[model samples]
Target: MASVTYILFVSSVVQAQEQANIEKLGVERVNPADVKAAEDIADQILTKMAEGSYYEFKEGEAIPEIVQLFTKDTQKQAYQQIKAQVGEYLSSLEFQEAYSLSQGGMEATIFRFKGDFSKSEPEVRVVLDRDDKLAGLRVLPWTDQL
Candidate 1:
């Protein structure tokens, strides 16, 4: 029992540390064009979600890259949940910031955006891998602290 408890605690700490690292965003330098491109990708995605019937993915107005398979499925479910919570999707307000993080020798750029919907506003994050592929996407309620 004692060993199991210790292992669980250690695993939790490791997960916390990983999240902390992402929050820190050590890299200071970022390309302006890259940020713009990332923002565009994020915008395209949200726009599609807003327009697509039943929250399905739209065909046109997408970045020319592959979104992660898991992300696509997960995003569909998550988007549905968000739609239920926030009502219909409207328009995204603005792009916030983009930052890069490296893990296991691979680097990914994460971009933030402020989103607008019928019922609520949310903050969105889009992650693009080194090859400019969509790696991850998340939407959360807006918080002042970010």
Candidate 2:
């Protein structure tokens, strides 16, 4: 019984330490340049998406590969869904945070933003690949209440 209790206590402490280390690492891995580039891409994408003109950038205006990631149907569906839930876009996005990570020999940067819409504020995450092209974009319902 005593041995079990000691093991449980040590395990809990180790877990706590690991979590703290992860938080520290996240803070240390941020790159301001990467964050800025990712933010620029995210702003452009969000603006176009909200305006229902995503396809307009397909003809050599933006990164073709990144633009192709979301098909026309998917973009339309996502645009409609966001409009229905969040109403019209209110203002430019506010940057929240960013982090950098290595993935399969490539470096990736993820920037998070608070998007202000007419109805609700959503959290938008944009990931940029090593080539500074958008690799992933996700808009999640805001959980933080002001």
Candidate 3:
């Protein structure tokens, strides 16, 4: 009986720690307007990439400053790599959360999404600058196996 009680206490503490870690990441609910804008931009970009129209984003779709960070060639290569590894797009994208961070006096919002690919489900993060331009983007494999 005492062992059972101890186990329950330990489980609760572990759950609280996990919640705290998530909060430390700055994840929080964002305004509905911001969520809509970010989702629209992210979805548009992802859709285009899935359709093999990588070069089209070189225009107004993405900010030139941020695009230079990855370079056009590198961006195309990354897209191809994802396509090869993840197969084709499966279209199960759902907004997960958003976080705000400041760097060099500029504020950026990170929008996260749990998206389905042909091979696996990955978390997609799209960072937008104050002007609503893409500042950074990344796709990482996500799993509950942890």
Model 3: per-residue lDDT, tens digit, 1-146?
A: 01100100112222233342222133335767766776776666667667766534446555675555554555556667666666565655787777666544556566777768787667666666677766666666654321
- Report the Cα RMSD per candidate: 8.9, 12.3, 12.0
| Model 1 misplaced stretches (Cα beyond 4 Å) | 1-28, 53-76, 144-146
> Could you estimate the TM-score for every candidate?
0.63, 0.65, 0.66
What candidate 2 gets wrong by more than 4 Å, as runs, is 1-29, 55-65, 143-146
Q: How accurate is candidate 2 locally (lDDT)?
A: 0.57
Error of 2 at 81 (Å): 1.0
* Highest TM-score model number: 3
Q: How high is the CA lDDT of each candidate model?
A: 0.54, 0.57, 0.57
Candidate 1 local lDDT, 1-146, one digit each (tens): 01110100112222233553354343356666666766776666666656652223335322333322324555556557667766565765576766655655556666766768777667666666676655555666766543
